[model samples]
Target: MNLKSNYLLFLVFLMSLGCATNPFTGKQTMAIVSNDQLFPASFKQYDEFLKENKVVEGTEDAARITRVGQRIAKAAERYLNANGYEGYLKGYQWEYHLIEDKTKNAWCMPGGKIVFYTGILPVAQTDAGIAAIMGHEVAHALANHGQQRMSAAYIQQGIAIAGNVAITDDESRDLFNQYYGVGSTVGAMLPFSRSHEAEADRIGIILMAIAGYDPAVAPELWKRMESSNTPEFLSTHPSNSSRIAQLSALVANARAEAKKFGVTGFTE
Candidate 1:
């Protein structure tokens, strides 16, 4: 067989061997790096980050962060169990911390380690708003986005290596490197990230609703984010306007889903 055929077979094998099911979507997704490996490294990095940053503690805001995060986590477990994916969160060690940072951002690592920056509180505005943010961040972890991203990076690197090995001409290889880097990022990676964000948004609203927080608050939160000058194209997240519209459309369905979980009333 030719070298090109070997590379193609290797790529196919890699993809086939590194697949896991997304509990929420029930779809097969990339999982080149297993959670057993990813979670320990993620937990260590989270601990290191906390040691390097100021973590708010013993305050009302700090307590609220933990409270909302726990509720979202419970909602996730309920959803997963109800959908026949019991014990899906067996290895998850959930922890939430509010960091004393000016950046209006929050993130959840692979194994349920979460950090919320202080600057985002003004944007969150209320408990429901906080839940809106919390649910979205938590959904990312629940959906295995971090694992997929790492797997995708491995695939991207593998493709680059194959391209380099195939190109004998030095100048052609150099040109391929430059164009491939930009093209792959803009054409593939960005879109992959945006899809994750959107999936998180959809899952988040359902979680917030099940947790007894108004899913309607999600669109409002995005509206505020839009007013704060969030950009659109070539970004990792969806444009705020599109997010708002999507959330608005999903609010009724979220509420209905929550109703199935015995959560009929939502607090704003």
Candidate 2:
């Protein structure tokens, strides 16, 4: 077998071992970095971030952020327990904070540590809008998107290393770098990231609904995001227009899903 064939076989083996089933998607995803390894490190990083940043506390917005986060977490717990995923979050230590920042963003770390920037509050506007963003951020953690991203990065690196070893000519190597850089990133990686974003959106709307927040307002939050003007293909996130459309379509289904948990009369 040639070097290329050996590399191909090795990659296939790695992919097989890295696959794990995501309950939300009911599909296998890459998880080479296990929660046991990722969670502690993420928790430490989150602590360091809080220590270095101005975290708002004892205010109405900060209190709301925490309240919404707890509700979302409870919703996730209800879904997981009902779906035979009991103790799925056994190792998770959930924490939520509102950070003082002008950047319109929020994120959840690997083990349920979440932060909401103040700039996003204006876009969020109301309790339901905040729940929309909160649910999306928490969904990323619940789906283990962080571990999947790490695993994907490792795969991308391995492929690049294989190319370097198999191709001998320096000029050929330069061409390979050029094409592979664009092809692997735009063709493979960006799509992977975008899919995660969409999955988060789907899971998020459902969780918000289950938590007694109106899922219908999710599209409105994205509609507010549409002013950012980033194109879908080039960005890590799907276009705001695409997100809005998807959320609009998912609202009824999300509401129905919430009903299974005895959750009714969503609040707008």
Candidate 3:
């Protein structure tokens, strides 16, 4: 990288620091990737995953997932449009799926490709329980966490690339890449996943409230999630107690957020 190119990259980095305020907390959030750059690949990958995965047929559960996802996606769109990100979702291909798996987990990939595992149905004890999980996962996708994780990995791999250039052989380059991959996954990805979990808990409350589910029930859903505390590696979520306390503190604020979305008559 020449001096001018290096300066240009730095300028790119600075320019990428676009700000979008969080509607729930009325706070600014750090966002690096633009929706213009981020949406296309996410849409492609989401379509590919749907084609490959065993997407559940439109059963009652599947319908529920789709319904909840659409509601949340719309609420998110309203938030973005209201806050001047009017075209942020112009290319977003929102999707939802329910898979017949027994693992107590659910996730929404980038570009709104969501999955609900049958195994998690027990933990998601009710419609509200499902809403809790949906809110959290939708928040992750909306916040561009998947792209941020990839960007963080790119930085780690870039350092390994630097190390490889100093070495003599392709074998050494492969070794460094392997090490970088492992180190990034264990060190950066886990912590990043944990942060997503925490942020989801916080953001999820307001989302659920805005969608008119009782945000107070958020803690109760977390209590159910607590029943299975696998190792941190096995489970990417925060501990139950942590989520419970966090959501409890945000109930008032979640209600306040609900009003912004015109959600009234929510349970206290």
- Lowest lDDT block of 10, candidate 1: 225-234
Off by over 4 Å in 1: 1-8, 226-231
Best by lDDT: 1
Roughly what TM-score does model 1 have, to 2 decimal places?
A: 0.95
Candidate 3 to truth, TM: 0.76
Q: Write the per-residue lDDT of candidate 2 for residues 189-258, one digit (tens) a residue.
A: 9999999999999999999999999999999888887454667788898887788889999999999999
* Candidates in order: C-alpha RMSD to true structure: 1.6, 1.6, 4.7
Q: On residues 1-268, what C-alpha lDDT tens digit does candidate 3 reach at each position?
A: 7554564566556545666555444565545565567777777776787788677895998898888778778878887777777876666778888888788888887667788888898887767678888989888877777766666555555555556555568898788788877776777777777887888788887788887788888898777764545666645666677778888999899889889877887633
Candidate 3 ranges beyond 4 A from true positions: 1-38, 163-189, 226-236
Q: Sorted on lDDT, highest at the top, how do the candidates line up?
A: 1, 2, 3
